[model samples]
Target: MTRCRLCGSEAMASVVDLGATPPCESFLAADRLDQPEPAYPLHLRVCTDCWLAQIPPLITPEETFKEYAYFSSFSTSWVEHARTFVADAVERAELGADAFVVEVASNDGYLLKHVVDRDIRCLGIEPSVNVGAAARDAGVPTLTEFLSPETGAAVRAEHGPANLVVANNVYAHIPDVIGFTQGLRALVADDGWVSIEVQHLLTLIEENQYDTIYHEHFQYYTVASAIRALASGGLTLVDVELLPTHGGSIRLWARPAETAGEPSQAVTDVLAREKAAGLQELSGYTEFSARVAKVRRDLLRFLIEAADRGETVVGYGAPGKGNTLLNHCGIRPDLLAYTVDRNPYKHGRYTPGTRIPILAPEQIAADKPDYVLVLPWNLRAELVEQLAFVHEWGGRLVFPIPELSVVEAASSKEVTA
Candidate 1:
């Protein structure tokens, strides 16, 4: 944290100190409940020189990804997003059957299945053994290996350079920002396109999405800083697309410097927006910590009030971000009761630090909790529709981020903060 991960600058400014929490995805089994758990400082800092927001590399990708619990296929909306992205990328990149596509951190082949459907030769470099095996079982050719510079070169040398390299939702996971970017550069053809999607720091701050801050995400990016990060590996920012995934994300289209003519007008527009938000300077981050505090306070107040009223409250998703929210707000099983998730892997496991019991999604319907706290608020629209049946029991859905919001399950109307 003393030096910026992207730039070696020693001048780092505090963004928000989320105190300490265990690795967000480290769900505890029943036997481990009595054992001691480790925690790390979760402070976020921005490089004054590069304006790149990052946390200390207390945990390594190997520790987190080797036996990963998260599988992208569990979320239907995310799967559809990947399908649509593959179609769009294929058309945009002019990829054909003979073309080879590579995806970094391709979790459970959520995306490459689309590429395979089109008869396009593709490979998935996935770090997680379990999820990677699942990907292979799903008929997507996957390499169970992390993407280092050497790994990238070996892949290119064996299978030939990739026509399109797709990295979505993982650009922020690696601690070695520069080396990971270089690995990406090594995977793609000299003139090939590299499509990367990462959560935009602008929406993260603007929408009070502090829950997204966790150990897994090593760094946050603004277009201004992203341009600099991409340049470190000889990649040039070409075009950018603003996406609605994971609250808000940026789909960065980049290429090798030699063939990357000039950045699109979209890049200019996003940079302008970032600048207008004062993200290039300390002004943009000054109010974020206060806003994050308000979110925590508002959420805790609602959960406490609900418990006082003898009403039941449960969480909807056991996402990593939800752990951060639960830990930061000091919510335990007493306040939330028990949360339900569609992912069966988390059904019998307890949340990392908060120790909230995770049940199957059917538990919500079976128990008929008065309030269902939506942890993965980024998928608000999708979850709201899916959980509409909660209204049958007069249940309401509570969203903790972007301010506390209580919406009627049936009418989908806002109740109160």
Candidate 2:
């Protein structure tokens, strides 16, 4: 990426080069194991001009989301989070039964179902054919098309401008940040609200959540850069909220530039926090590569030491972030044994580059592995409780990010470093 995807600047600073890995979601069926798998350079860079951290757009969104593997409804906490967000948004936006709501990248109707329950008019724009079908089956009106300016305008023209456009966890997924933001503006009413939830660059760096860097996520954002990105599409940031989802995320409330008025104190506070952290300058990123290396070293050390001790370590969730960590750490089935996921679509498949076999969640209890590596470590609270049954077999749970830690499942207590 010689030029910044958002700013068009030639000065791109290196953040960290994770070597190369396949598209994180490219799970393989048993039949394709003999075929060659492709990998791409997984380097992250920040544009000096805009301070937006991004990766090279090696793989297109169509390649990854056309038949997406992720199902949002799989996580109970996330589902409830969506339900709560819907309730809050309706109340905050003063939405009524006559109000119209739209969700971009609405996965399996996990969120819009709440909108439907309220008897409000709603639509979902999902790219994946399979998941789009699932949303339709769940009675959520959906368009199986990628969100572009044209698609957004067409939806707005047909259904009339939406009262609210909810884009959760998808702001970083698109390579064309400006165009995607324009699509957002095209879908929303001039005075309607746009709520976006994306992983905060500040949290990703501070918490050592380097595993979230993948080809699919073309860019990362701090509130400062996010304000610039929002303006590029005629939307203005009005408020910001800190969220705990995906390790740490920021929920941005925006509106058409004309109606945006002044940003809330929350926005000013977050911007001050980012500036104080030195993210606006290069100082904040100087030590990040070294810290990321420490994370890689720590995780590899734990996995290798456990293998040498004759302890079996399987994985808890086959999430995309897990693939990045596994591939970056050079972990194969030899080190991880296998991983389990609740999503049935992945049960018989293999993780993209690591080639770690993905099994059903029941297999973890069946095999009684000595240690279970919780790859989706961001869900620490929920997974720790769910896997507490491991205590029955005297097993423990392991978390790799934000430093490697071992927990006794019996009491759900941190036991080791």
Candidate 3:
């Protein structure tokens, strides 16, 4: 029985056992297939004491993130999401040209670029050299280092305190939750607030999003655990707003605990919703493994049946969620001919473990396979618009997670769900 990362308690139990899998971002060149690929347990367990869900320590941050392939600018909607966030935050915080902003794990400067365009002072801390170089080229100042308490103090000493600190999808990636939160406290101005976006645990279980459980994501948090994490770092939660990004996420507003007071009704409402949904109990997590098993079985059967019928099939995106889904079901190139991606970094590379060939998006237009399995089904809205020409040849788009459904030509409105 491994102890929980947050509270160090020995009371933990399995939520879902996803078996051994490779790091989701570990795409391989053609020559590397002959070499043995490393994989680790993808099981998720929850601390009965804290209700935090996380995978055991099988890999280090350097092993998973350095030389990373995921760049944020690939998605059209996500960039606009950042633009909207910047506009709202700038107005809310009353930031001026002299005020400073900092972003932790800011990939490729996708969000910080918007801040710079407004003539606001901003800096990004990204660990990946390749992505950091891209950010610098785009004219956003970036520091190439993993965020720690020491690094945060150094940044404050040189650049002064930040008016706003932005962290998106970063908390779950690191093992040291307390240290990372402390780093946020060290960087932000005493009166300034931190805005964070993380996938809500309620959404993960309710939607059966098992594909998000790759090795890179060490922890899953509910509103309850989030409050605990922030409080440990001398921060206080002020508000919580649920977002539709990354399938489902929550944007948390926080400030220094000593200067902070009562959390808003939105925060109370979310906590009540989570408790009413039974997320505070061990039984809420125990039932998820069965749901994950059903998805694995149903998706495999659909692909096998389609292949047996002689209908050609391919994939739409090579997202981390797609990598987990493909590997968990043991689907190979035969079941899914090849997957296409817009990012040049992933082109000509094979997905880790499954070895499914990846091609550019143009391949879909030339081949026009009978079925184009949308791998990153969460972005089905944008993809459906971009790939509408597929419907001309009677090609149908399909989503395997949550449930297996062959989407109709006119029913793309489910994206709001």
Write down the worst ten-residue block by lDDT for model 1: 408-417
lDDT of 2 at 178: 89
Model 1: CA > 4 A from native: none
- Model 2 lDDT per residue over 171-199, tens place: 99999888899999999999899999999
Candidate 3 Cα misplacement greater than 4 A, ranges: 409-417
lDDT of 1: 0.94
Which pairs clash (backbone N, Cα, C closer than 3 Å) in model 3?
none
Query: What are the RMSD figures for all models against the true structure?
Result: 0.7, 0.7, 1.8
**Which regions of candidate 2 deviate over 4 angstroms?**
none
Across 239-346, the per-residue lDDT of candidate 3 in tens digits comes to: 999999878999999998987789999999999999988898986877888888999888888889889999988999999988999999999999999999999999
TM-score of each: 0.99, 0.99, 0.98
lDDT string for model 1 (243-355, tens) is 99999999999999999998999999999999999998999999999999999888888888889999999999999999999999899988989998998999899999999
Error of 1 at 51 (Å): 0.5
Rate residue 93 of model 2 by lDDT.
Answer: 89
